[model samples]
Target: MRFHVLTLFPEAFEGPVRHSMLGRAIQRGLLSVQIIDIRSYTHDIHGTADDYQFGGGHGMVLKPEPIFDAVSDTLSPYPTRDRHAFPVVLLSPQGRKLDQQLVLELATAPGLVLICGHYAGVDERVRTHLATHDISIGDYVLTGGELAAMVIIDAVSRFTPGVVGAADNVQEDSITSGLLQHPLYTRPSDFHGMTVPDVLLSGHHAQIDRWRREESLRRTLENRPDLLDSADLSLTDRAFLAGLGYVGISSLLDDGFESQE
Candidate 1:
């Protein structure tokens, strides 16, 4: 897959794109990232990319012409109307919240073009006419969108084939499976009076799997109970959770699990 990043500060990406999984993906030819400086498209001697807002905003707003030109130039080689064509996404707090599902959806795309807004924000025209999607990492705002773009790239890249060392491990990632992952322990099974769970050391595969599933459920219930509403739960799983004192969804609704506070 390919990713094109449009930002005023292309240098901001140098460190991240050159290290870790993203770098390895690039080396293996499984992923490609092109950093395009938005200022490059500007016609001014100063390569100006932003200016005062129309109605007088507190900060400068990204100019529309340069952004539009950059996106158009990038897509000029492909059929823009095709569904398989790359997506032009703008990073902003107003966009749909980024999540595991969104990451998976973007992974299916042939490529992505991310616009990292700075100062006040990108002009509304760019969002209305150029971008195919607007995405946010979370509820909070950032000084700039460069960090958000990097996050989106890393998360989406994990789903690309051969990007992660063990593809199966991605399926077991926290939140990817709609639950927190079970605890993991390595060598020194016994340490400072703390011993590894006997089930893990017993060479009992079936029991190990069972223990993992139950522990995952217990952790999710304790840390993020809200996820259970949409989590894939079978009858047996529900029975097991009930055994751990968690109210069944049906019972919760029927009796109204009111907060003691």
Candidate 2:
């Protein structure tokens, strides 16, 4: 997968994307990222990318011309009419909240153009005409969209087949599986007074799998019970959750799951 980031502060991306999993993915040719400085497209001598709003806003709004030119120039090489044509995404607090489902959707794209909004925000024209999608990391605001773009890049890359070492790893990821991941313990099974669960140490694969499922449910119930309503739960799973006093099981049934009882 390829990601093109359009930002005024292109220098900000140098460290984050060039290290960790993203770096390794680039090295192996599983993914590619191109940072396009929005200022470069500006005609002004100072490379001015923002200007005071016409209606007298507190912060400068990103100019439409530079953004439009940058995106158009990037997309000019590809057939614009195709379904797989690169998508232009503007990262803004006003956008739909990013989630596992949206990440899955973006991973399928051949490439992505992420517009990192700054100051007051990108011009309305940029969002209305140029951007194909607008996405937010969460409900809150950020100083700029650069961090959010990096986050989307990392997440979407995970679904690009070879970026992650194991296919099962992607499948079993916390939100991808619709539940919080079960706790993991390694080495020093006996620490202080806490001992590793015997099922994990017993070399009993079936019992270990059962323990993991139950723990996953317990953690999700305790931390994020809302997930269980949409998680693909087996009758056995529901029974386990019910036994643990997860009262939201009724909502799951209302969504059309057959009651285990």
Candidate 3:
């Protein structure tokens, strides 16, 4: 997969994407990232990318012309009447909440064009006319889109095929399956007064699987019971959760009602 990012502060990306899985993906030729300076496409002699808002605002808004020019110049080779066919994502507060599922989806795209909003934000014209989709990390606001872009890049990069050693590593990842991962223990199986679960040490694959599933349910029930409502559950899973004194449909519905209230 290829990721093209347009930003005013291109220097900010010098370190994060240069190391870890992203760096390795680049080295292995499994992924590629190109950082384009939006200011470079500015028509002004001073390379001015932002100006005071039209109707009066607290901060300057990024000019749309430069953003459009930068994206257009970068994606000029691909011919697509539907702009969304290529994925032009703008990081903004108004965007859909980005999650693990969305990350997995983006990782499969042919390429991604991420626009980093600055000052106040990109002009509405840029969002409505140039961008295909908008994504926000969470409900909270941030200082700039650069950090959000980096976070998104890192999160999605892990899902790219061959970027990680094993496909199952991410497939079973927390939130990917809409459930948290089972606990993991390494050397020093017996630590202090705590000992590793006997099923893990017993070398019984069937028993170990049973233990893991139960633990995953327990953890998710305690931390994020909302997931169970949408989780792909089996008879065995339901029975196991029930045995653990787990609350099912009742708790799930209650959470929903509380939220609406």
Candidate 4:
């Protein structure tokens, strides 16, 4: 897959795109990142891409003309049908929160056009008329969308074929799995006072699997209980969690979890 990043600061992406798995993916021709300077599309002498808000806002808003023109010029070579289905994502705090599901969805697209909003934010027209997806990395705000665009690229790239070492491992990742992952342990079974779980040392695959399952449940219950609401649970899994005081969804079905009842 290909990612066309539209940003005022194209230089910010140089280091990131040349290192880590993203770099490896590019080296192997599995993925590609093209950085486009929004300023390059501006018609002004100074290449002005941002301007003072019309309603007298505190910060300057990114102009719509440059962004629209940039996107048009970037996708001009693609077929008409392909351009219509292309994803033009705008990074913003007010957008839908990014998650593993969204990353997976974006991976299905042949390419992505990411617009990095800066200063106050992108002009409203870009959000309403041009962008197909408006996404936020988290609830917190950032100084610019450059970092968020990198994050989206990394997250979505992991879903691309051959990007990660084991493609199936991505599915079992912490949030992608729909629950927190189980603890991981490597060589050196004994680390001072801490020791690896005995079940892991044993050669019993069934027992080891069971231990991992329960550990994952235990960790999720302690760290993120909200995930339990939609997590896939079996009778054995529910019973295991119930012993640890986690209320299963089925148990709450009769009363609907209302404390009064």
Better of 1 and 3 by lDDT: 1
On TM-score, the stronger of 1 and 4 is 4
Full-model lDDT for every candidate = 0.89, 0.89, 0.83, 0.89
Q: What alpha-carbon RMSD in Å does predicted model 3 have with respect to the real structure?
A: 4.4
Ranking by TM-score: 2, 4, 1, 3
Which sections of candidate 2 miss by over 4 Å?
81-84, 251-261
Model 2 Cα displacement at 43 (Å)?
A: 0.3
lDDT of 2 by residue, 1-261 (tens): 989899999999999888988899998999989999999999989999999999796999999999999988887777766434678999999999999999989988899999999999989999999899999999898999999999999899999988888744988879898998888889899999798888899999999999999999999999998898788888788777777756665755543455445
* Model 4 whole-model lDDT (C-alpha atoms): 0.89
Off by over 4 Å in 3: 79-84, 192-194, 250-261
TM-score of 3: 0.89
| Cα lDDT of model 3 by residue, 1-261, tens digit | 778999999999989878987888898998888999999998879999999999896998999998989988888877665344678899998998998778877877788999999878889998899888899999988878999898888888887778888744876877887788899998798899798888899998988988888888889988988899888777677766666666555543342222222
Q: Candidate 3, after superposition: displacement of residue 81 in Å? A: 7.5
The C-alpha stretches of model 1 lying farther than 4 A from their native spots are: 80-84, 251-261
